[model samples]
Target chain A: MNELPMSHHKHNDPLPETVLRVKALESLLVEKGLVDPAALDALIDTYETKVGPRNGARVVARAWADPAYRERLLSDASAAIAELGFSGRQGEDMVVLENTPQVHNMVVCTLCSCYPWPVLGLPPVWYKSAPYRARAVAEPRAVLEEFGCSLPEDVEVRVWDSTAEVRYLVLPMRPRGTDALNQAQLAELVTRDSMIGTALPRSP
Target chain B: MNGAHDLGGMHGFGAISPEPDEPVFHADWERRAFAITLAMGAYGRWNLDMSRYARERMEPAEYLRTSYYEHWIHGLQLLLIEQGLLSAAEIEARMQRIAAETDAGAES
Candidate 1:
């Protein structure tokens, strides 16, 4: 899903202090020959387009369409995800949790920004914000509600605290009346927030 | 060092305002910062753990004051200088030049 334009700042304004610091560092790094500009561009390109939520969406869609795949995903998420060639740093040990009628799952890394980078690309600014890190664990239900996800009283909410040793991904339930849809179409309904357990997959 | 960056379950930081259509980077320099950090990391001179530690090791006030990518550039600068890739003097001089350029732009 394309991100809606963030209204945090006025476009075409002067860059922030952090931006200047970053620019200085990049210039220094290149001037010193510590980093190759071309290599940097290639790396940026990979995360910007080639990898990200789309990769994770495909995995979720595949699991939703195939029961065997769902079983494998739950039993050994790392291997199952690697099946789709989405395995690398921060994702070396991933555990996929299935959302069900009785169970809801959410993921948060309390310590720093330990995330499944290969599958999720870089984490969003909100995900890295001080407010999110502090509130996600203390008041997970309220946090979910803020994200527009309200669970029934009968459903149990499980918040997975991600660590450097292991990262977690939430496999959102397939929407109703999607039985007719193929895996590719199912992926179209799967947004990044769904896998993060902040929001549910779009209804068809 | 369990610093401000380890912000899980703490309070008073306020609500997360997600920009409706936030680009991956807010500024051109932010994109470059992301790329440079990744590029330096790719060289294998230091592990991700070290970078995290470096950022956490930053002064609490400074760490809290700086932006997310700012922590990255700070840590990257420290690591590169420590590894002898660049001298501290060179970084400081370049920063001074940048400040001067900004001042000149303001005057013009």
Candidate 2:
């Protein structure tokens, strides 16, 4: 069984433009003579060392290697991801939406920055802002094109609106030539954007 | 709180700036940051574990409000504060001190 941790939710309400709120809180702390800059920096450094992208790569690599697992992943993402010991913490509930020829899928947290962190790691620089949330649903193809990804007109684009409690990840079609590759080699193609459905796996 | 920068499909506003001169964040950084954000949460016990937390934890409005990098940045900040590494006032004092030092150094 996966070790499910607890989260501190229940205070959302559009979050008051998170950046502004954080900045406000930070400034308030600074003004109040509360926070120590050096300590904060050091703490950030510690977390930086402890956290990394390897886990995200692992999820992608695993999906690439096992077909049975892949089917399982598509059916029950939370359990499939956990099979590799990648579950819990920031990631609780998960759903994997595959990109098929008939229908294209894109993931977005229109309300807030909900994402599949276990598989893809963190959200990219653009994935957590107003512009992207509003635009992705409005113009997914054009947005994807900006990321150097474009689907043919024949493919229908379906956007996934991730909400509270349910996070989503994109299981891009595995590239061809990768059949001969090992897990590590396969991981190289699982870019952060690819797992989020912004980019595609490299042409194998 | 959900990390801010996981906006996968929220690009509909579609390149506010003109394409040629639009701001371009490095793809590698995004990958690195995402990885870090997820890992930190994994370590912090903020959710049911790494996989479950990352795959879940989507709040509708807040998720859209935060930029992708902001999510990592926010998560890290939250962790720092939560861990008691630096209090609110201490950080400000350091910022002021640094600014003063920089100003003095530049003048001299």
TM-score of each: 0.89, 0.58
Off by over 4 Å in 1: A1-17, B99-108
Top lDDT model:
1
> What shift in Å separates residue B71 of candidate 2 from its native position after superposition?
9.8
Clash counts for the predictions, in order: 8, 73
| All candidates: DockQ | 0.48, 0.14
Best by DockQ: 1
Residue range with the least summed lDDT across 10 consecutive positions in model 2 chain A: A3-12
lDDT of 1 at B47: 90
Per-residue C-alpha lDDT of model 1 across residues A1-204, encoded as one tens digit per residue: 123332221222332555556767788878878789889888778877788888999999999999999999999999999999999877999999889999999888776767788777778877776666778889988888878889898899888888778988999999999999999999999988888888899999
Candidate 1, residues B1-108, lDDT tens digits: the string is 567677777766656666566667776676788889888888899998888887787788666555677777788888988888888788777778898898999999
